[model samples]
Target: MPGFSFETAERTHVGCVRKLNEDRVLSRPEVGLWAVADGMGGHQAGDLASSMIVDALSSIELLGTGYAFLDEVQESVQRVNRTLVSHARLSRPGTVIGSTLVALLIYDGHFACLWAGDSRVYLLRDGRLNQITRDHSMVQELIDSGALQRADAPYYGRSNVITRAVGVNDRLALDIASGPIQEGDVFLLCSDGLTGMMDDDEIEAVLKARTADDAADHLLKVTLDRGAKDNVSLVLVHVEPSVDDTLRTARRTLLA
Candidate 1:
């Protein structure tokens, strides 16, 4: 009720190549929780890791207040980490299982985002697109330090090398931020399979399409057409004023 939006649409894809999809998307319109997780590991472990993170987040109820929303997210992520580590060690002692989590919580026209790895969130508004989360990958760090130019980003370093991830590290250090939201704005949560295979320009073109489901399907199609080498997942949400505002106001007046 606090968040803007009386409507929503969402979609997810496993891509073309990988037999086991290691990506996950979760959405709760009522609570204004939307997220994406991309997992990394060997022997089908990646699939397990990413799903674990999503399930953890989905299980928790969205808090009634904005400040409590992030706390719920943090606690849920940590619980998933412990669970993943325990599961991985018991089943495959040497195998490492971890995942990147990007989540958005909207309340009272404000948004809070948290990132653990390369999975990302984008804000599209007024014909412009902006990437709101900074990646935790090796290549991103190099770019931040001015050691790598834009031309060299895709190939300069082990672009897959992530500095932080849920379940891989004992003590997780997540990047969290918050901001305001506006009507007619769109938010995208996607795995690297989409970002890795498509550039920002290409993504913007597809995301600007008519509807969220259409945009999501088009994006997935583009990834597959590009020879998707990994699993891909996407969640698109549009922010519009709630249509029920007038009805709710009348009810409030009657009660008063």
Candidate 2:
């Protein structure tokens, strides 16, 4: 498989209502990797936890034939979880630190995603938006169990309560999946900050704009304008069909 470079940009904001931003994001353009994380614990613990996850994942390299992308990601996440748990115990007693992680890993004309909690990844192609990640929250669980209607998810109580998150439990349940990519395709990795404030339609409209940087900035701005109740983070990536030899070699070595 050949290697490709991703053109990307990211932006995060405290928003109109939040006193401090707890969202964190990281991107590796050479590897075509990106991630968005939203912290759950109160105080600055959430911010620290989210940053640790990004830092851990950003260093991981996924490459080669039959490479273990999912395993590597899970390991990195676990390390971050441990770090968060240790920090919580030492610095902030009784402060449970956890976060939702949504990431994109581009490889060989396709991409794999690892998602947990309520953060999401959306695909934009041909002027349309399709949500690619499912939320792991109480509302989604009810929908799965036939206890709640899908259409009523927006207004459902406990909608913000996430079912799965890093550092929340000893073992985490993550939703992992893969899909094909196309030229001119745009991918969005965002926290609940944007999705909770703006619907899918609004996000698609802003993403279909001129460039990745513009899209990411606009998304954050729009969320804040709409009364961002929490810290907002967004990462926009445009994948093209071109390949880079250096990137391919690095990924190959990582796998080896």
Best by TM-score: 1
Off by over 4 Å in 2: 1-4, 86-94, 243-256
Worst 10 contiguous positions by lDDT, candidate 1: 1-10
Report the C-alpha lDDT of model 1 over 95-202, residue by residue, as the tens digit. Answer: 789999999888888888899999999989898888999999889888989999978898865888889898886688889888888888889888888889999988
lDDT of 2 by residue, 1-256 (tens): 5444577899988888878888899888776678999987877778877888888888887556324766787788987877777766776567788888998887667888888899999999988999899999899889999999988888986778988899877677778878778778899998888888888988888878768977777877777777888788889888764566666668999999
Poorest stretch of ten by lDDT in candidate 2: 62-71
Task: Name the best candidate (by lDDT).
Answer: 1
Q: What is the lDDT of residue 221 in candidate 2?
A: 74
Runs in model 1 deviating more than 4 A are 1-3, 89-93, 246-256
